[model samples]
Target: MAEIKTSVTINATQEKVWDVISDIDNEPKFWKGTKEVRNISKNGNQISREITIAFRDQKCLQDVTIVPKETIKAVFTEGVIVGEKILTLKDMENSCELEALWDVKLSGKMGMFTGIIKKHIKSGTEQALQAIKEEVEN
Candidate 1:
């Protein structure tokens, strides 16, 4: 599996950072790799959704769990990719830290290009974190 992790320190409180990251509907705004999100169902802190990824506009089914101000975990259920992506938020005295962890691998014939895909995802994740930081700090 391709594993990627990236983090950013935002000049904002945990609440501010949480407000930005927890707004899952606005995910595509910061996550360039995510083209669109369609909510299929919701149960308390858990959600089932379909995400259209930028990789050839592939659609992936994900089961997501939200732990309020702590973390958001999305596990890929059915798609071209298989694995999980997690976003964690840590509160500092006056600032907050946001970290993203991705452990995934391409399915079927696309598995051969996992190395290339890893690089792309890593860059995209860094960009996404920066975008979130900018949004929260401002």
Candidate 2:
């Protein structure tokens, strides 16, 4: 699997950070890899959606679950890639730590390119984290 993990220390409370991340519709604003989002359904904190990814503008189906101020887990169910991406938040004395973990790999014949894509994914994740930090702090 192509796994990428990254984190950012935001100068804001968990609640503040949660407010920013939980706005799933605004994901494309911070995550460049995610070009667009279309919600399919919603039940409480769980949502089913299709997200357009930057890679060939591929659309992936995802089942996302939000755990209040703790975590956001998105499981990719279909498309060119499959696996999960999780966002976790840890409260600190004066700020909060936001961590993003991606465990995904290209499907079918494209699997061979997983290693090559890892670098792009890692860089995108780091950039996304930095964007989030700037959004929250300023």
Candidate 3:
């Protein structure tokens, strides 16, 4: 399993940050790599959505587990390789720090071409972090 982790400190409260992150329907607006987010269903903290992600034109059906105001875990249930995203928010002094950890395992021909995909994923995460910072601060 390959993993990518990135973090950013936002000049906002944990609750403020959580408000933006918890909106499962607006992921495409804040996440640069996400082209669209279609809600499939939701039950409590668990949600199912179809996400069209940037690069390689990958469309994935992902199941997301959300812990309101604290954490969110998303696992790919269909398309491409198995992937998981874990997001955690921490309160620090007068600000909040958001950390995102992404783990993915490639399969078939896609497994052999992970170098290119990894770079895009990393860059996308960085952009997403920056977007989150802007949204939370403003």
Q: Estimate, for each residue in 1-138, the C-alpha lDDT of model 2 and write its tens digit.
A: 987888989999899899999999999998999999999999999999999999999999999999999999999999988899999999999999999999999998999999998999899999989999998898
Of the candidates shown, which would achieve the greatest lDDT relative to the real structure?
1
Clashing pairs for predicted structure model 1, backbone only: none
Question: lDDT for every model?
Answer: 0.95, 0.94, 0.86
lDDT of 1 by residue, 53-101 (tens): 9999999999999999999999999999999999999998789889999
Model 2, residue 101: distance off in Å is 0.6
lDDT of 3 at 21: 90
TM for every model, in the order presented, reads: 0.98, 0.98, 0.94
Candidate 3 per-residue C-alpha lDDT over 1-138 given as tens digits, one digit per residue, 9 for 90 to 100: 678999999998899999999887888887777888888998988889888877566889999999878899999888885879888999999998999898986667778777667777778888888998997787
TM-score of 3: 0.94
RMSD after CA superposition, every candidate: 0.6, 0.6, 1.2
Candidate 3 segments exceeding 4 Å error: none
Better of 2 and 3 by lDDT: 2
- The order of the candidates by lDDT, greatest first, is 1, 2, 3
